[model samples]
Target: MQPQLLTVPAQSGPTEAVPAVRPVRFAGLRLVHAALRRDLARLPNALRLLQPGDEPGAEALRRHWDFLTAMLTCHHEQEDRRLWPLLRRFAPELRLLVNWLEDDHHNLDHSFTRTTTLMRIATRDPASAWSVAYAVEDLAARLETHLRIEEEQVLPVMTSLFAPQSRVGTLGELLDLLRLADGPGAPDALAWLLEGVAPEQIEALIAECDDLTARQWPHWQAVYARCSAELWGPAATVE
Candidate 1:
């Protein structure tokens, strides 16, 4: 369900800390933002290889675009389904900001769709390579803006709301929220999520994952490592 932008509650001082049985703090959100930034930063280089005279294979580029789109879609869907409603309920003061984030999601969806269309065209018509590259670059610019705002404003609000002592505090809840529909079994998505996250944060995320995720993670890491090297060249960072 969508948020009601109107009827916002008045901001009354600091909210009382709700007691909790198990106080677990989750840092998945910040790490996800970092992952997005890393991908966006590398995107320009990926696209640059597609300049008019460049010889990057169209099919390979299309696959790369598809992987990126899938990862981003999964991240946004998880936030929309699990994060926003919780924010609206517990952090009433951030209601307007939550609504704005929802709006940002919609805008990002449009950009993704447009970029995908360009990618498809480029797949069939190599002459359209520059156009596809331009589209991706544009998407990166918009995504970067959205991400900066989210990290600076929304993340702190989430940290305060989900503090360790909070009644709602549970790493499981946030970890589950971070999960995509394909679950933790999908190597590409998992790799993308872990990319650019700090070592400690990765440990924290792994600690909160289910048994199956923990069991499969090492194997998937190895598989994606090989795939990344093949796709981005040996020197490229896998994440």
Candidate 2:
């Protein structure tokens, strides 16, 4: 699916269409914040499974590890391609933060790889799981801190620095970049956003995404449906 470039709305005209929800640009960042929160909340459960002599817990840890690997890797990749470059251009004073984020991405990737490798070994050789679990705990701690910093500092900067129209454009670029990197999960991430957002906010997101290719819409819709079912069950209705 090709990502459509966002159209710049008139800056000063009162006659311009008032967006139905929060602009996609800000909505996207809020989505990321929610995801980070969700993942962090799951860390303790993951860590408990890693305790020594807990075979069942070890298996549980492995499951969480796989989920985190997929989610965090996708998140970091999207930021590297879409958010960082634009931040560099629009907020050069934030260069340090961007660089640190990039470094953290590498750190996270390394930790995930290491933890995955250990998980495979531990699955086959139970004694090995404890060692891997300790490493994962460390990684989770770092990740939690990183998430807090990004949410508290980075997101606010993004909200304040970018114009509404430019923010929407950047969001389109970010989504497109993620689609290239993670395929359907890019939209899955979008669906994840819907959980934390108000209905009105989602309407705005859908409008912004409408700027993209028609093909992308199906992918995003599928993601929303899947996540809604998984997160909220069959009874959940998506606006």
Candidate 3:
């Protein structure tokens, strides 16, 4: 007797083949690049909120803070779990860089915590907003520099060392982490990243989600839609 091949029903809606999972080296760099752009764009708006006014800037600042905190935390977690171990295995010479990166993460966390505390204070006492704004600005500058160092010095080494199989596993790990960390405001943060990416990069990201489940699809769509509208005005739309 011939064995019958079991077939699953196709999901409804726009579906595309999932691209090969991004390489670990490339994925790390892309994630950081996307995140940095979002934070930089929002920094000005957040700073503006500190200005003495009855305007709705406070809400904006709070939202920006929430987004940044979540993104940075998730980024660091991915590095700690996926990136660092692979680096230790592939390029042991770069252990120093990993150490430095870890230290920088701690330093960045301190700055973020300080900024968050001050922002909370400013909520009730608008007079204190300037101090919080200054801290946030300083942190943003530091983070930008840190990202550049990782991109230039660290990622290339990783790209050279990680095997293709490892890269696929690492990419899967990253996606799992992001899904686990997704909160009420995650879509907004993702939207912020999406808006800053070039057209081609946007297509790449969509391609990354090609195999996403039917349930996960609508959540992402809603997130992309709402975030685009809020951050980029009416021009924001998923392509």
RMSD of each: 9.7, 7.5, 10.1
C-alpha lDDT of all candidate models, in order = 0.62, 0.61, 0.60
Q: Runs in model 2 with CA error above 4 Å?
A: 1-25, 43-67, 121-138, 168-171, 182-187, 196-200, 211-239
TM-score of each: 0.72, 0.61, 0.71
Taking the tens digit of each residue's C-alpha lDDT, what string does model 3 give over 1-239?
Answer: 11111123454456765433222235534654556655555555445455566445556556656766867777787787777887777788988989889888888888788777777677556777666656667777888888888878886776667665454323344555677765434344445445444444444455554364323644766666654454334554554
Best by TM-score: 1
lDDT tens digits by residue: candidate 1, 7-113? 32444457845322221243445445555656656655665565454444556666766777766776677678777899889888888987888888988988888
lDDT of 2 by residue, 88-199 (tens): 9988988999999999889878877876787677765665645655765676677778878886778788878877667533445546656777443555556644554455
- The candidate, 1 or 2, that scores higher on lDDT is 1
Question: What range of 10 consecutive residues in model 1 has the weakest lDDT sum?
Answer: 1-10
Q: How far off is residue 10 in model 1, in Å?
A: 41
**In candidate 3, which residue pairs clash?**
none
